[model samples]
Target: MTISTEQVQTAGRLWQEHRQAPFPDSLRRAEFGGTDVWVLDLYTAGCVLAWLDNDGILDAENGRILQSCIEDLARVIPEVNDPAGAQYCQQLHQLAVLISKNLASTK
Candidate 1:
């Protein structure tokens, strides 16, 4: 599979879905889709995508930054009241893995 710009755009949009939060509170546990939410899940997904965006998996430290970005998105998007939040999050994650593998194999 090819890593399309659409994938990157989607990932970027996901990150900026909720950009108005102050700071630390940007990634927190709250009710999403009427269920309990956790930033860790979103963080994991975002890190996966960021790894793909960078071409492949990071060594170590930068991977943490990717995770943080996802965490931040999770904290904020829910506040935007998107009902499909979880679904979009999962797609971004799967796309990230797909993109990483696709780009890595081509290298």
Candidate 2:
């Protein structure tokens, strides 16, 4: 199943509890723009979406590895202090995962 961008945005808005390590923290609060939140969500959503869209395009084994790579990349959440970059990094990581998954699930 594919999640729409709008839906993701809503989910992000609803989310209140700040995420912890390996989920996009940040080097500094100012860096991530107040505790690395939105960016993380964006990244996560992107990863999933990308996988769904690209996984199939890649070969079986290659696709799977790609998915795994994306997953790994998205795993590390910057530093708690670096909120400015943290959020963005998280979002970008998510996109990586999304793309990876999409590429790996092809028949």
Candidate 3:
């Protein structure tokens, strides 16, 4: 149940990439689409991972929060019509799942 060094490294990389991405203005709009929500969800999970990276720990509460974000994003992915957006969601989903698994093991 120990968190692996590789998991921590991967989380760090994902957090860096997430931080570098521009915030989507569509996220503020009331009429936002699946892609917009996807971006927002990714940001949420990235923030959780960032906390883990900074503190070198993932509590059960944050782990639960991360799991919720991942599940919510998964629901939105199928609603995304754009191929590029779908692919992006898929990639993020994979990373999020990995992080979630590692965090779960910590608990």
Candidate 4:
């Protein structure tokens, strides 16, 4: 998939925003939306941003994988007890939505 300049710019901006804070360390287990889920820490969110920035491109395969990760994170956002972690996850979710939209545009 060919990534647009806008997508690259958006990814960069998101990466910068994600890096502004230290990743949260607490892990909590809870059920959300009637499903058991593990709340993701800030590290996971950082990894997502890093993955996108590292590649500078989101192909079909990798985009799917990353999107799934973001979706999973979104599902458990309510479960995250740490305010920072929830914010990070919310940022990650936004990044994921951007990637998904870009991928769809390419298709």
Which lDDT tens digits does candidate 1 get at residues 12-105? Answer: 5645553322223322445544533454445555555555456453535545544454444455454644445545544444444443333422
lDDT of 4 at 83: 84
Better of 2 and 3 by TM-score: 3
Question: Judged by lDDT relative to the true structure, which candidate is superior, 2 or 3?
Answer: 3
lDDT tens digits by residue: candidate 4, 25-65: 55344445653333333434544554465545444556566
The residue-level lDDT of candidate 3 at 12 comes to 76
For model 4 the TM-score comes to: 0.63
* Poorest lDDT segment (10 consecutive residues) of candidate 2: 12-21
Off by over 4 Å in 4: 1-3, 28-56, 104-107
lDDT of 3 by residue, 13-76 (tens): 8766755655444333312343357445656665465556644456667666667667866876
Q: How do all the candidates rank in terms of lDDT, highest first?
A: 3, 4, 1, 2
1-107 per-residue lDDT for model 2 (tens digits) = 45456544443432322233344333323233243344435444444444334423444555555455445434445443456554655555554444553342255
Give me the runs in candidate 2 sitting further than 4 Å from their true place.
Answer: 1-56, 78-80, 100-107
Indicate which candidate wins on lDDT. 3
* Number of backbone-clashing residue pairs for each candidate, in the order shown: 1, 34, 0, 0
TM-score of each: 0.32, 0.34, 0.65, 0.63
How far residue 62's Cα lies from its native spot in candidate 4, in Å, is 1.2
Worst 10 residues of 4 by lDDT: 35-44
lDDT of each: 0.47, 0.44, 0.61, 0.60
**Evaluated with TM-score, which candidate comes out highest?**
3
Using lDDT as the yardstick, the better of models 1 and 4 is: 4
